[model samples]
Target chain A: MILQLIDIGYLVAVVLFILGIKLMSHPESARKGNSIALAGMILAIVVSFFTPGLNNIALILTAIALGTVGGLYSAKTVQMTAMPQLVSFFNGMGGAAAALIGLVEYGDLPVDDIGKGSVLMASLVIGSVSFSGSLVAMGKLQGVIKDIRVNKILAFLVLGLAIALAVYVLLSGQPKPLLVYGLVALALIYGLLFVYPIGGADMPVVISLLNSLTGVTAATTGLLYDNKVMLMGGILVGSAGLLLTLLMAKAMNRSVSNILFTSFGTAAGPAGSGQDGD
Target chain B: MDAIINYISVNQQEFYIFILAVFVGIEVISKVPTVLHTPLMSGSNALSGVVIVGSIIVLGKTDPANYLALTLGFLAVLLATLNVVGGFAVTNRMLEMFKKKPGKK
Candidate 1:
């Protein structure tokens, strides 16, 4: 009966998420949408406490408290001009959480469960990439890291290495902790290199893509555990991210891949033309 | 191959739900005007905080002996918390400014 209640809670949360996104498309209802989504999140978290197998109540509460304070402080203090960087930073955090969960879960799985292993590897790879890549995006936006020229040959080489590592791990047929870690490391490096070349003009698109990647990672994690709420939340975020990325790209009159690969800021138009003046 | 197929078949309902979500997600955000893109991005960034749910689940289920899991779980909670709280607060700030603009008519 309790399980049934939790399921109902998840169902309501998913409905609210959909409604929230639907309402957010226009300025008139955006604020209400956010509130609705916030309520959904609170409901999901509260309902999760009732699930079977959860323990360490005090630690969980402490983590939530610390996170709440940190999130609230930064949100309240950050300037509007730095919104992009702040968004990237928060998105990176979400990615980091998903990647870490994938890493922690890797040790417990049985060998030969290729299905589960594949999902775990995907979450690990995508999450690590998003985490590292979003940090690079933040760095670029903050001007802390400059001269991010893309070396195509080098970028391709790193991409090659990442792919090779993923293939090697897949073929090995068992979860070797060393190779898993190596795959994660390589993906992180690839992410850094991937975002280094993309200019600031493309940040919105890049941020959206990273957001989607984080969502995909979360969804994969949800799949590993068969958690309905997590799965639904992840899917919603993923699709929303993709949609936003496309919309932002369209707003700038650029293709998604073009924005990603070409350093438009350095090569052509006046600085800040692509971005809105707030 | 058979294992993968069996997995999908077992989770058919979940996949169906995922497909339905994709449609709704794409459909809902189609009407957001360009001027609000930044605010929309920030708002959805806050929504990504939904990952906190996954982090909590992982931390709660992790064995106490596994220090690595414990540490990672703690960090995940910290980071996701930052994302959720910061993302929303910043979005609200931006939206307040947005409301004052003449464009709202």
Candidate 2:
């Protein structure tokens, strides 16, 4: 009975999320939409604690309290122009949380099923990448990491290695502790390098792409545990972030490939410029 | 063929829900101009904090004695909570300026 009620609560939360996103598209209703989404988050957070067998109550609350203080301090202190950096910083934290969840879940899960293994690995890889990539983006925005352009070849090599590690880990019947953690490390490195070379003008697109990656990671965790609310929330945010990325790219007269492959921003054309060769 | 059909039958509800939500996401995000991009991004950043549910579940269901899972879970909660709080707060700050603009003008 309690389980059913919790599911119903999740359903309500999902509805609020959808409605919130819908209203947010318009200028007139954006604030109301934000408030509704905030309410939905609160409802979901409150409902999770009500699960019957949930342990470590004190620990969870302690972490939440500490996090709240940290969040509010940063949010209050951030300058208006630094909004992009602040968003990237917070998004990175979410990606980290998702990656960490994937790590824990990967350990605790029974590994015979191929589907579960795939989801777990994908979650771990994507979460780590998003976390590190977003951090790089934040650093760039803050002018901390300046004028460092990584060789494109090196980034791709690292990405390839990360994929290789993931495939090997998945194919191995039992999960080896070393390989699993190593997979995460490689992914983190790739993520760091992935966003390192992109110029400031293009940071918006990178941030948007990373946001979607984090959203997808969250969804994978949701699927692994069969939580409808997490799945829906993750997918919704993922798609929204993606759309924003595409639209921004269009506004800048660049394709997604153009942004990723070439240093498009250094040669950023003036407004109403035609598409350059890919 | 039978296996494919069986799989779809089992996951039919999930698949339909997924597809429908994707459409809703596309529709809702269709017309956003660059002006609203910052608030919308910040707001969706808060939405990504939905992983907090997963973190809570992991921490809640874990054996308290397992140091590794406990530590990771604790950190996950800390980070996700921060994400949610920071994302929403930033979005609120961004949106508040819109209201102030008319009055100041």
TM-score of chain A of 1: 0.91
Against the reference, the lDDT scores of all candidates come to 0.81, 0.85
In model 1, what lDDT does residue B15 have?
84
Worst 10 residues of 2 chain A by lDDT: A265-274
Candidate 2 lDDT over residue span A1-278, tens digit each? 98888998999999898888777766778889998998999999999998889999999999999999999999999999998998998999999999899889887777655566677888888999999999989998899986466788898898889888877776776867788899899999989888876776789889989998888888888878788898889989998889988888887777777677665344455732335535
Model 1: per-residue Cα lDDT over A1-278, one tens digit each: 99999889988987887787777778888878878877887888888888789976788889889988888887778787888898899999988888888887888777577787778888888888999999989998888876477777787787678677766676677778887788889889888988987876677789889988887787888888887777777877888889889888877777787777666445555665434433
- Residue B26 CA displacement from its true place in model 1, Å: 0.2
Task: Put down candidate 2 lDDT per residue, B1-105, tens digits, no spaces.
Answer: 343365446667766776776777778889886777778888888999999999999999889889999999999999999999999988888888878776431
Deviating ranges (above 4 Å) for candidate 1: A264-278
Candidate 2 residue B21 Cα shift, in angstroms, is 1.9
Scored against the true structure, residue A69 in model 1 reaches a CA lDDT of 89
* lDDT over C-alpha atoms for residue A104 of model 2: 90
Error of 2 at A230 (Å): 0.7
